[model samples]
Target: MTTTGAVLRIQLLGPVRAWRDGAETALGPPKQRAVLSLLASRPGDVMGVENIVDAVWGSDVPRTAVNGVHTYVAGLRRALEPGRAGRSSGAVLTSESGGYCLRVDPADVDVTLFHRALHAARRSRGQGEAGAALRLYGQALSYWRGEALSAVPGPFATMERDRLRDLRLTVVEEWAADMLAAGHHAELVTELPAAVSEEPLREKLRWLLILALYRSGRRAHALWLYEETRDLLARELGIEPGADLRTLHEHILTGHPELLAPGAGSPLPVYPGGLPPGTPGPVRLPPVGRDFVGRTEELARLEEVMRGESARGGPTTPVVVVGGTAGVGKTALVLQLAHRLVDRFPDGQLYADLRGADPERGPASAAHALEQLLGGLGVDGARVPADSAARTALYRSLLRGRRVLVVLDDAHSAEQVRPLIPRGPSGVLATSRRYLGELAARDGARLETVGPLTAREGTRLLAMLSGRRLDERGPAAERLVALCGGLPLPLRVVAQWLAANPGAPLGALLEQHPALRTRFGPAEAADGVPTGQFHVIETS
Candidate 1:
């Protein structure tokens, strides 16, 4: 009988190697080894001879490819089970239904073990087990002895080798970030430069190297590295360093305290809800209104402001305070703009309701607002500082070099909004009932007053929300818009009531909810300008 009782171990991670019963076995020529590697990639999965030939030779297929496959299989069967009769069926590599399946346990494959360990490492990191994650990462990295699938011939092997190399780099980068967070910068200082040397164009690796050096008290070296990177990036790609690298350089120059390593015995920050580093940041913008209608002019103006000083050829962060009476759709307008411009801000878009108009809760204190904002930034609640000023400083420091959009809804005052504003190139869009003139004068915030929709826009909004075939020019729609004073909230409420109770007339709905008709009280804006003959209903 063949020596098949012992478990077979296959290593496809580095060079193709096989150990049968703890002894290395000859795997034949390169094509035969390529065939074995493909099967090992998916242990126990049946692979057809045609598919194998295609993967091995790609377009330059040989005329005797099928015969060549049979020859390779015979060779593998003889090497893997020398005791089997020449004409007898093989056990380790079996042929069934015109396809071959390497019937081996997946755990015996080094690639499978590597992937499993990497997954576990990410899980541990997400659970705030930084020490465990570091250990697991090291275990996963230990699987790679050199380039994966080294010298294994085939299109499949080439593609898989590239993919595996990329995964290795990703794990390395994530490990470096966790190391820095856990105050192990000294370890990274020794390891990261080698990785950077191998991937000189990868800015993130260089960024981590600089940060690790800085935290390890090599400030001069870190600065020199940044300048070196700037020159390298310019020379190779003909472009300047990205926003993140530039921001990190600036902070390093000033010796920003936020860049300092975590204190001894302090807990390392968990992955943002366990997400892998470099994963997209949290998307916190509230859902946009489905039946939101016009505001072409208003949307364009806000978009320009949200574009920050970029559009104006300046270098200041943009803060636009949307001021208007309640129920005028200021929040809706800003949220819509934020969603449209989401692709521009890859870091994240953060939102918080300041509760400026919440009579029960009153305006949320600046300190409370900063806490909520920090939470969106992935800061652990317990880690937040108690002092308001310290929290604000931390908040600003976290935002350095990131392109985030901060949307503060229903803000109370300039003071309440100021502390929550993000630093650097991030933009802020805040809505408030108050005009916040003080904000404009002091903080250079551009004030955009949201007024009631025009009669046409309001009529269209009602039709869309109610899904009715109402005549845009009909008296019924005109009276409805005029009674609602072109304010989106009351119009929406009336439309929803009509939609829910299909037979309910607009008049009957208005009579039941008299608050819907309260918007026609004044034609004055919050700052005393004539705001057309529109009524305003305060919304929570």
Candidate 2:
């Protein structure tokens, strides 16, 4: 953990340690440190007792191992959160069925921060944000103090040490690649020699160093280093230089114009985060189904509101909230609308899974969501303000004067999405199970409720999922819709069940999947329809 003002900071990138209010708290013996490191390795996940035991003691079963793990966790909890009292839920560590979890935020763990920064840097570099990529990559590489998990004793810590070191080297290599593309040949000429000496046979660094040297007008020295690498490989591994290094050597000899500029004048035209360049790159909207059924009126209404008018399309509205219960297909409708209207917003598109009501991760904090949004817009993670207020300001500044579409999906509340809303001509489309009344009242967000798909739409979806023409599907399709209560998720599941069994009737297919059958089974009139599962509907 980097620790600007966080209440607690834990570091596993170098050693197992804790700090609170500028003081290092004592973590007991080797076993206790190993347990904390293992739990921190999977922050927020419940590490099963058996898994922790295997990590700590290996296959040697001690009768006291489980009891020992319990004792260590008790000690860790006390040290991690001293404010919490006896028999109460500790803020840092908590017990769950059959095991325990260290419920610390990823921002408070150096390991998690490194991984996040490295991935974002890769994405930024992919999108031709050379300067932004370098900053992110540099921030990611800053977390390595020494060998990871150096103070913790166990197979898990030992393995993690090697893995983290290897990861750091890879990030360094990637950073070199970006630097070369950005015309940093002279800088590399100075920075790469020590790294080469440390890992003499790492071909990527060698290739990069050779290119950097050649580009820096040191042809004689570059040729000498190539021979040096070749000799090292031949001496240690008894193999010739691989094709990549050889190709680079040839390119340097011939003065390939490709090496003249960053990204080889081949800035990945694609938007960062995998959205194709011409489309809204930030939007997380899923692919729309080709056989998407109705919602004709609903789609029109959404498009109209997004255009800043009523259904008539006149005035300027900055936000649109699509509200629906579990399986009314609000997300699908919004995604389809975004894809349809993407060309209108030439600036970009942004999407976020707010994880509202998520069973595993719970509701995502707005600050975390904003960081992702900011990164996608070419802001460095380290440069992202630590406070939510400043982060929100920066996000809005990036979106100002640009016409973009921001989709906040599965939002838990207006407060979560409030800071994320665009304050410009760039419009937003948000989906939630609740109506988000505050948005309508405070932000002038137009709300549209998505109801269960009409029976016809559900029938069409079933036939499409089953790989049969809608007209050719059996009469049982309508009956299946009744069984599904016109909900798209369960109906889609039933369609898969049918596709799996050739010539199987829909009713017969239900028998094969007891769980799906339980949910999709015809409901008694007196018992009423089940409220259904919000978690599965949103997540699945």
After superposition, which runs of candidate 2 have C-alpha atoms over 4 Å from their true positions?
1-6, 83-89, 253-540
Q: Model 2 clash tally?
A: 8
Candidate 2, residues 318-430, lDDT tens digits: the string is 78888766666778888988887787776778888898858799989999999888777755565566878766755664454467788888888899999898665677888
Tens digit per residue, CA lDDT, model 1, 439-470: 89888899998788889998888888776845
Model number with the top TM-score: 1
For model 1, the run of ten residues with the poorest summed lDDT: 267-276
Quick one: best lDDT, which candidate?
1
Q: Candidate 1 overall Cα lDDT vs. reference? A: 0.79
Per-model CA lDDT versus the true structure:
0.79, 0.74
